[model samples]
Target: MKKKIKLTVWMITISLLIAAVLFVLQQHSFSMTEQKIEIDTPQGQLTGTLVLPESYSGTVGLVVFVHGDGPVNDTYDDGYKPLWEKLASAGYASLSLNKPGIGGSSGNWLEQSMEDRAQETIYAINWAKALPMIDAQAIGLWGASQAGWVIPKIVKKVPDLAFSILVSPAIQWISQGQYNTRQEMILEGFSEKEIKKREDYNAQILLLLKEQASYESYLRIAQSDDLISKEKWGFFSKNYQSDASEDLKNFTTPVHLVLGGQDINVDVEETERIYREKIPKNLLSVFYLPDADHSMLSKKNASSPLRTYLTAVFFPRHIVVEQYLDDLVHFVSQF
Candidate 1:
């Protein structure tokens, strides 16, 4: 009897290990498979990867990813795989393009304005529509951060965009930057005087930006602060002027706006306020993750802004919250 009981325990343990390995292998297979493609925009050609869901057939919906600020490459700074894989499991095809100067794409990304970026995205959408495997009428845009400025412009131009998913979108470009700065300062425990200095600094910098101040003039303003590098100044000058108030109100596209309550970047509260005011009830849907950060990762101490930032940057930041994926799946399926 004792020998029989020991054999049973061994068999159960072996079965559990085999099951775990098989599950991991299945997940690997479900991740999006890459295909090379190129799109011609007004500026130049964008070389990108069209990722199709494994086992997907019979014309799946397409999701085109736009990047946030900076030189975000085709993989969205190497943080898009999990999200894209989740979408793939839900039977969606997705594309992520290398910015003009990043991978095999053409043109200089830093020189492009919001209008230029929007045009690039439109080109990508058209390219996706032409693919034999994609449902053209069901194409949608998915992006976060600076994409908030780009996506609305896209829906405005196309007017027939199938759906959209915005994660931690900013209401407006300049205001969002200010909001980010303030939030960071508060988290770093800046004093009232220090915060006031930043506010004053933001006012002046924005004024110069609005006036289309020369790079040299911006340099003069930056001499007082070392935080603004030459690279950063160039990025701001090129992509800084955008107001989404009109676009937000006018976009009739089905929008699933996701906000992270623990996000330490943009003022999620302010963005939500604008959404409530401008977005029509029928047009807008939402998913709020109270303990998730801007990247939809679980946070240990969301209430403490400092801990939130550190966790997002250094440790355990790559774990995607399950609810974020579920929210996206529900949004995509409904539309």
Candidate 2:
């Protein structure tokens, strides 16, 4: 009788634990209503998601997300939902579109220039503004990484934007690339001599890009295993000159800049300095997260593959710095 009672208690405990896990997963969607949205642009049809507050009666303010880099899909494989949920809770709507050739969207992402990206975002903004459920005057942008090059251009064109949020944005393309390479090398324990050699190679590649050299020209000089594809080369040739300093000066809306101190991909200090020099103090707000990485993920989680996987699977919302999400909501709430 004692053995049977112990077995029953163990079974009950396991059952309750499973039930709690399921409940957490079910509630992960939070209080947001997400819908499949499609936008037609000159480039092609864009597949996207429009997330809105579940219980709001009036039109909500909208935030259109611009991807940093890569062929990212809407929601960034659900990585953006935490942010979406935060926005929803604050009575705001968020829109995110998959890059061209991704998630059934038409055209090719690598074929687009920075200007093309800005124009595509403008198209999304205009489409959202026409919806009766979104307040046109309350529309803004949230972008990161390569988006630093894109968002400022959007701000330049859309002078009346409600606000702009930039995360780990770099000021110049060439310098940012160099910084990333150096930091990554240092982290990997590369010697000074080896680092200098790689930088010299990068300089050569930059010169080729500046000269508009063809793929064949690059092939002749590139190492056998280091050759970039023609498409990637074309992308580099088109955007290697990207510098946001001039475009940032055109900002006419409130801007919130988030920088992660432990970020290796960008020189956050340089980004902050340039932003301060270019944007008026009254229009810019800065948030610095000392323990975060380029993606605003905590250094502890970002550095451990096992921890990253475990956290992403069990606590996806906490994959990034919780404070980063809170700051995003706080900044947008003011508007």
Candidate 3:
């Protein structure tokens, strides 16, 4: 009877611990107090916010958030607030910028190359390093998606970079777009034959870029009824030849790469394969969450493209799962 009672007590204790963990996860999301900050860059005056955590003391490390595609606002006003808050509550400072031509910042993000973005971000890194409240030695970066290309460029040249947190980043711009096209078609329930037709056309574009072929070559790939508009061709022309494989090889900083196994926008398997092939596993901590989609939310309910495009104007509709949130916190805490 004594042994039976002891087992019951242990089980109760375990249940209580699980409940406490769940409670902390649920309550972790909170609003943060941030300072309006801006910096002058050669391209324009870059504007952003340096969000601070409450009830913290001592010089804290700062996380500079590098946004993915499109014009990202200073706060990532759409979806990133919760992440900033969680990081802040865990004793790290966060900063996010208004991309060029967005908010008070000038210049065009679309017009800038990976090189231009890296230079601008390097400027921000220097600015953060010099700040008195920031732990200059612990300045790091957090980026995702298109930033997969941009962050590698930054790390390749800047050896002093402290660390990095990457989520659902792409490997090659060209292949990534192909993956998006194919997977989007699959999600829309297209036939395997239709998928191959699209993928084959994209492959031709890769060959054209490699052969330094003319505009006519790419034009041939654009079908008359295709959803891709002619106006967007400029984007393909500028970035189709770019890849981050070399940049990944040069990365010396400790990196934590997170992926959504169910991500429809990117080829997660290829991404993991390349990272392991290019960098030593010792410098990396990789996570593949099967149930999470590209947004690190549920695959069953991913955010709409329209909603993502309007992030500068409103709040994010989706919240990252507790599992992802926990993994991020644990990774950042290591540094």
lDDT string, candidate 3, 164-208, tens digits? 888999998877888899889988999999999878877776687
Worst 10 residues of 1 by lDDT: 310-319
Question: lDDT values of the candidates?
Answer: 0.80, 0.92, 0.79
Clashing pairs in 3: 78-316
Q: Which stretches in model 1 have alpha-carbon errors above 4 Å?
A: 1-30, 224-231, 301-318
Measure candidate 1: CA RMSD. Answer: 6.1
1-335 in candidate 1: lDDT tens per residue?
Answer: 99999999999999999987776555444356878788876677899888888886589998899888778888764467677777888888889999988897998787777778888999998888888999988889998878888888888888888988889888777777777888888888999899999799788888887887776787777746455766666778777767777778757878888999888777888887788788888888888898888767677644556765554344322456678888888788875
In angstroms, how far off is 163's CA in candidate 1?
0.5
Top-down TM-score ranking? 2, 1, 3
Instruction: Put down candidate 2 lDDT per residue, 98-180, tens digits, no spaces.
Output: 99989988888999999999999999999999999999999999999999999989888888899999999999999999999
- Report the number of backbone clashes for model 3: 1
Instruction: Candidate 2: give the clashing pairs.
Output: none
Candidate 2 Cα errors over 4 Å, as ranges = 1-24
